[model samples]
Target: MNRFAWLDAFLGRLIAEDMAVREVPEASGLAPARGISVGADDWGNFGKSARNWNCRWAGCWAEDLGDQLRVHACFEKDHGYLLAHTDLRRATPILSSHAPYFPAAARAERHLQDLYGIAFGDHPDPRPWIRHQAWKNGEYPLRLDFPLAGNPLPATPADQGYPFQHIQGSGVCEIPVGPVHAGIIEPGHFRFHAVGETVLLLEERLGYVHKGIEKLAETRDAHGLARLAARVSGDTTVAHTWAACMAMEKAAGIAVPERALALRAIMAERERIANHLGDIGGICNDVSFSFGFYQFNRLRELWQRTSATAFGHRLLMDRIVPGGVTTDLSETAARAQIDQISTFRPQLGRLMDILNTSPTVENRLIGTGVLAPQAAAAYGALGYVGRASGVDLDVRRDSPYAPYHTLKIPVPIEQAGDVAARVRVRAAEISASFAMLEQLIGGLVPGPVCAPWTPAPPDACGFGLVEGWRGETLAFVRFGTAGRIARYFPRDPSMINWPLLEVLIADNIVPDFPVCNKSVNGSYSGNDL
Candidate 1:
């Protein structure tokens, strides 16, 4: 952090103008990682950088180490980023909120509040975001003392005490949907404020499916943790697992085999292809185009079936292990997979052309559910959603890691930021992912699939940032005294994009909300956890 004048000076300025500080070892470094901190009294003054929008705020999380709470802030430093942690030692758990500067921090802060019993001053929203009145007051579940089998209410009452915002104008009826939806999807509630047919606002109520992953992750060994990461969000299995593996490997300073790196890239691209196929189809189905849904569902099923043949799981779950990946390609299986992609690409191009030309599809997508580029950037939008809105920041290209370092990936950028633009981005990404997969599969090198294991030194730490199908997925890890996970935080892109969902759906009608929501497709389980 001290390397760059602007970023380093920002912290220097904090120490000079605000509070006395100390420097500790950083949890994870994207290479040359360091940490500096200011006292709790000066925390608010130092936060002025985020408040002034000097740099983009990546993520904020807390670790309760009995005597004190360790809060880490991850933010980008131009092309690279800096990781910093602030140690708060006090009689009471209280600190200033980062939500004032980064709106995305609001959810993370609320999450910390419910999980760790931390209090924040001037928190924009005081309502419970994760707890949902399930546990008794004064009981923080993630404070190391909470039992593994949680104390659940015998008869869970309806969460009628939540203070959802209301409107008082005539004809402005509210539609409350989900937490328990019709489909087999995860739970999340959506409240839409509408007048007649036009939507005035959309407030999201998530965290219904919070599985206490942070708490459970503490008990898992290295191999067990990798398996847990794979299940973080079932659809993002490959991305999440790779991120966890990369972080752990980095912490141990272990180099994965070249062949393993190439194989990991292959698995990631396959996951991307499958998810885009499903999302494109889902967006169409929401707009009453079931034909598109059927076409894509079939393609996705074929893709996953091939994945099962190649990696032994339809969704590629648990295939990415800690040191490397659990995969070795046979010529027969590799060739068949390549041929499947070759055949699928041309069909995808033709179908996309037909849908783009169709008046019904175009009308439902174009100029609808528009998210302004400025708003997108403000909310730290990632993946296709950010690209569609003219904010092109692809992790694979911008911040290259592993196989991506040796390959060229053209990030699809669209300026319209509407449903149609999202569709275009997905279609383009599907083509790009296919081409990348072709390169990875065709250029396989023979080597050991897994690297020899080395136990992390006490407090071993690293950061993993992978561009998942949905977007940039980040995971941080720090090992404990006995080589166990002391602190682990995975900030999903859905957390960043969900807040902006309110912005895009404002002018769109109630009926079109489904299509608009599908365009963003903020992961329910990913965001909830």
Candidate 2:
């Protein structure tokens, strides 16, 4: 199917129909996006048009200008991106919501309402999202006048009066899980309504770990923002840092060296492989398969140790700077990387084979936590979660950037949207990442690792899209006067994927929640921020 053909046809329709839309220069990036500015009144119509054209909603964010709030919506189809934005007056901060057209926009709109105090008119659920009594109802934290340190914490608990959905029926009881748990994990509250043992409905309450990441990004220099982006989600530090740098580099018109791009790909692939290994083991551990858990963790620990020796950090934090990577790869490190791949590849194959043939693991994983293809598409799920549900969307292949465009990247997909299917997808991706790493490392070009630093023009806008281990990761950067960061937004794939867990958990037994949750494994820290 020509997924993006409708984009051109839609533009033509806009021109012919004389809709209140105007084309504008795209935000700077490797690929030029179709940018359009829409009036606040026409925002919902714009989203409807895109939905009719079969466009997928990527993400939405709002930036607080001095007197107005600019809301941005991103859509993607067939490797193409269209950015549509609308501005609302600060005093009257109300605009039509896109939630009616795009279900994924609901949380994003609520997020804007919480931070920017922008009311989304006609929104289905207007409850506070990221604001768990951190601030008052009228005090917007993202505004320019708001203090960076923010208001003092209240003496009372923040989530005291929050409302959760209630189901009233015979034999239906609610089970409230934790904002804290016995095992080490991020904080989130999950409410499950079940009859007998089958889950009837599941509602999630997040934002316990909100650290004011977006508010802290304002006015930061290039290096400072880079450091902050790396911590947006520690597990995805390499990806987030790379994305922030890509946005800054594009805005400044600085081209990263070929060698640096290749090295970046190598590190990214390593990150993907390490995380997948850990996840595979975690899923098995949830099913009481301790052998798989211990073995996989053993491999992951060794993998991180090698990464530390090669890149000065186990998680590869601070490895990526504004222009390019922080340091160059040496001969010994490259050889060690290749050697590690060779050594672990066989062990992984053996373990996977044992898992595939084991009746116990197969019984626990297969047909568990099945997410329908329609539901997956509706939520715009990503990474292994979407791929397992047959949504063949990968930023590497769909919207290639830098070294990825030059390499042949294979995206593995599965039709079964179950725990087993997700595991299979991760194993396949690890294999694919191994192959890509070999290509990236073997074809190391001779050039500078980092590019020259130059200030971007004032008011310049740039977008960065990278397929992180979890899925399509996006970073948007706008520069103020003298190259100061006016606003920075990083959309982790978790933000979209976490909500789908609630939808997929229904009709399953409560005992299977652990494995099902692990199968989707949405990062609470990533989603909350």
Candidate 3:
């Protein structure tokens, strides 16, 4: 079907199904699609960007559907958003089930269930998503009435009796890892049931670091909300902050200065490079290559320190504000930095050669934890993971924004979805980002770095999507009267990528978990939010 025709048909389906639908002009994007409007609790009229022919609906209650929730389905271009809202008033109190239609929605639904005291009826696998053992069963912190101070007394732990399907055979053994680890990483439990060394089944139990970020955002103003967004993942601070600011400005009908937009892009690319370098080294370290690890790590540290010197923060936190950026790069500073990057290129090339030629490194990573193209698409994986699996979707290229439009982004892709493929993708991306940075610095123009923006009108909604280091980082913002935040939803790519880990780990030996994990490298804090 044609684009507009397909959208109309989709809208028709929603309206026919008794769902509320509205076409919002301000929040609308390119033609042939519609913007759906929804009420923001603190921020007034928040609208979502949709095809000119999209549908908008209100609160929904979940219903059980065996192993998954079959609550509500809203279609997008490549994937759909299925939501399950549990009715807390019911006596039997069955959670509304959904997310079977879209694997990406599974993590979000699980989070809703955990925070809102809602249940996903017949969810395929209903483990405690965001609920840590810190609170009691009767305590639902996300509810509008839930106190922010938290309960004084410790609540009994929720029933921990999840029935994991077990595999039994000769030479079979169970391997449990984490919830506590040797490193400083966040806590997550992974249970691998294996026959000899080969993994038969893998079960993941996360939520050890649920920070209630969403709940916190629900109470703050736009500025306060942006601060919280930046903390979603420390490494991706610049990307997340930019997304939140973009969403707020869009909702407020504010246009950012061209120079500010350029600066934002530069910061984002720098952040991306810093992370890619670290991860490339980290993946090598996982396979016991300390030389590559130390060298790449040193490079990453140098890059981060450069960013700190330029932006006043190593991760560039708070550099993005609604309608603009917080600082500008002087011509002299830009030139010096660009020259430094040029000098660092040869050293990076040498490290790359060392890693590429190592037989031991290549052997462990080449065919380990293969995620086929189809599985990658189904999981809605993004960034390096998706690229490695042949899903060539980059927000910067496909959905161009800001300086990215002026500077063409060449996304690197690979057919192999193994650890080695992930490493190669990161390496390629780092090179591309450095090239783009040089161009941006060369083209830097002296102008105002920020524009003044008034608060958004009551009941305005806006959505922002940025290509972060991990993947596509999405932020939905709604503004209420008096400039308060109405509702904020920041969806990290980790939320979608983490589940793919389970699928990819299958049939692979238990010993390769670290290598496979480093390839994906999902943030536990980001996902727990």
User: lDDT (CA) for every model shown?
Assistant: 0.83, 0.88, 0.72
lDDT of 1 by residue, 133-215 (tens): 66766788888788867788888776776788998798899999998886656788999899988989889999888887888
lDDT, model 2, position 158:
49
User: Sort by TM-score, best first: what order?
Assistant: 2, 1, 3
Backbone clashes, candidate 1:
0
Off by over 4 Å in 3: 1-5, 12-75, 78-96, 152-163
TM-score, per-candidate, Cα-based:
0.96, 0.97, 0.86
> 1-529 in candidate 2: lDDT tens per residue?
4545667678877657656788776545524567788888878777878888778898999888777889999998776888888888988989888898888888888989998888888999999988887788888888889998777675736477678889998999999998996578888998999999999999989989999988888888888999999999999998988889988888889999988898888889889989999999999999999999999999999999989988889999999998889878889999999999999899999999999999999999999999988999988889999999999989888778889988888888898899999999999999999889888989898889998788888877788889999999999998888878989999999988988989889999999999999899888888888
lDDT of 3 by residue, 1-529 (tens): 2423454565565556444554345333111223442221100111122222332121122222223332222233532222212113433334434354456656676776766655666566677666766676667666656676777455546436655567787787888788897676778888899887888888887887778787677648877887898898898898899989988887787888888988898899999998889888888888888888898999988888888878788889988887788888876668767987887788878888878788998898889999899888766678899999998878787667888888878999999998889888998898889898988887877789888878877767666778899988777666667888756767788877887899999899887888898889998888776
Give the number of the best model, judged by TM-score: 2
Candidate 3 lDDT score relative to the true structure? 0.72
